[model samples]
Target: MIPDADPSADQAPALAEQAPLTERGARTRARILAAAREVFEERGYPETRVAHITRHARVAYGSFYTYFPSKEAVFLEVADLLFQTMIQLDLVPSDGYEPATLIRRANRAYYASYRRNAKMMAIIEQVATFNVAFQEMRRKHRAGAVARSAKAIERWQRAGLVDTALDAEMAARALAAMVDHSLYLWFVQGDDVPDTERLLDTLDTLTLRALGLRP
Candidate 1:
């Protein structure tokens, strides 16, 4: 869950309910969240310190606790903000397009959103490796995406667009896995990220081919 690497630029709204933030307090909290994102991205979660956050935010060290309970709390807020932004992208292509066209368009949108948040996503994967709750959250997130794709596949199958023999749920899960892992490899792990056109075209080709659409 990450993008707009300098979150301060957007000034993400505070998470969870609390007494309304005074204008000054709101600004300070936003600063801390922005700074925390920077520090966490720079140092990774394990290496990040409250002190680092305070210094970068330029807030008094003790004031960190006034806004957040702990490093984990602040991290969660920052992560949740990115997650919200990332999911705001509706991957389900709207009506009127052919199924194959919808798939390509959806994949392109997914790639763009993922690319914007790639830096935060790498850290999310790292944290999920050991954090059970976070791991489960990741699973749930993927499951939701897979479920959406499965429904789309089922619709396409009914229209005689997709191969009927294919199990919609299983096929969707495979396709979702393909897209997710490939993005991680291309954007997060690989040194040479492909040009925008190549990146979208490659995934579009592979996904469309896998769905038994024209190559």
Candidate 2:
């Protein structure tokens, strides 16, 4: 004979009440998030509203509140998702690659990711200008990349692959800024696209020269 199951034992914690949303509920939440992304990309943060997102999502007016608390909440979620996607980009080169080749590969990966998310990136930048929270988010994202690059630079310096006098953190920040602003200008600011091969080559050469990897 089987013993009776304990209802209390199966009960989830109060804090995680929403953790087990049903498949249908999950789909609705995803729809709302996708709609929020679309509205933010098209109308921007200032111009977008919960109504707009709900309409685009095709859910009942009340259904939105069931998942998100407010417009800012949903927008932040969308921004977080975009940043997570970007952070997953394959920027690290494999071992045994030359420094120039590694830099080139990293640049190409960043540019490709930026191109794919250009519109959302523009929206995130715009929001970051006036939103303290978003500004912090952007700063943290950049800091993570900079920290990784600095460590890589330090390793190169230890190996006598780059200039020992170069400050790793500062150099990483500067190189990251260079790549970011270059992509921003070309993709966000509507600058004419330069020859991709030439652009990558120039950037690679400049990076290598800066690191004293090449004369």
Candidate 3:
């Protein structure tokens, strides 16, 4: 008799478990995931299937099931990986750097990452609109980033570097919304892409001024 399939395998592995994959297992998983991203980007989440991913990956159909129990599991894994990469972006200042400079650097880095993953991001947004699981995943990702930003804003306020009157959490959420919405419009909606340097400069200036930072 055939063994029963793992029930938990239908869910993406927890973050801590993701790292302990054996070398061969990791390679196979990566192949499946890369295939998933490409298929999703080209055909979108609604049209994608496990067979498409397996064919694109050039792995046996059974191999795909061994790594990811379903297309949804793999898709969530891909989104989580992308979110983790973005979360690791840093704005920490060096010894002589000013806050404004650090903010500019952070924005530049963020935009660069966004550009690299623009297609996947567009897919994520589209899927999240109607998929409850994907929507919750998106919400959790944004909330974590906003919470970090709010804490940073609070620190800046205590140091007298930011406006004392602004509510830290609200300010953080607003700024995050501004960046996310602008990127979505420009990158995902086929709006004309602005010059990189000018765009960064404008964003940095607006962010600093919003926090009541003076030149």
Candidate 4:
């Protein structure tokens, strides 16, 4: 005995779900973030403004604020995205591989990512000066990367691939930190050196040896 619902009302929800980002909410938020990365990279966070992001996004100013409260929020998202991407890439190594093989696979994945986004890598150099908020966000982002490495090491320990003498978590943190800092320095340093692929390969072998893994 229930009345038939209005057809037009039923159609509205479907249309809303299919609308373009300019007309939808979450899609608009993604657009803002996409624009924010380019703007932040080009001008740095302090010099960049909301107008820049909105203009780059081709969205309204109101839309920008609807998604992010300030430029800081957008910058944090950028850092978070970078960290997430790194973890996603590193974890692609399969569970069946030995710890050394997994470590090498993860290293290759990380360097491939860096090569793909060299510009964003450059932008990171400038972001540290912005404020404590940015600094804290960057730290959290790095900790996530370190955690990924730690997980792989723990897996190795569980599999009996590495010595039980060294603390896996500590070793992982040190190794991850070393790789991150070394890659950054290699990119920014002024001396002529081996290409990224070669450098990463060398590091992979060296890291395995240092971790007491055999050939």
Candidate 3: tens digits of C-alpha lDDT, residues 88-199: 5644443355667667767877888898899999999888888787777777777767766776677678889887899988988888788777778888997776677877
Please, what are the lDDT tens digits per residue for candidate 2 over residues 1-215?
A: 00001112222111113567899999999999999999999998999989999999999999999998888878877877676566454544345666666677677877788889999989888888888866776677667667667877887888898788999889888887877888888889988866877876777777778888852
Using TM-score as the measure, the top candidate is 3
Q: lDDT per residue, candidate 1, 51-120, as tens digits?
A: 9999999999999999999998888777767765664554343455666666666777678888888888
Model 3 misplacement above 4 A: 1-21, 90-96
Global lDDT scores for all candidate models? 0.74, 0.75, 0.76, 0.65
Q: Give the TM-score of candidate 4.
A: 0.78
Q: lDDT of model 3 at residue 32? A: 92
Candidate ranking (lDDT, best to worst): 3, 2, 1, 4
Look at candidate 1 and tell me the lDDT of residue 32. Answer: 96
Query: What value does the lDDT take at residue 206 in candidate 2?
Result: 77
Clashing pairs counted in every model: 0, 0, 0, 0
Give the clash count for model 1: 0
Best-fitting candidate, scored by lDDT: 3
Q: What is the C-alpha RMSD of each candidate to the true structure, in Å?
A: 6.1, 10.9, 9.1, 11.9
Whole-model lDDT, model 3 = 0.76
Give the distance in Å from residue 5's predicted Cα in candidate 3 to where it truly belongs. 44
Which window of ten consecutive residues has the lowest lDDT sum in model 2? 1-10
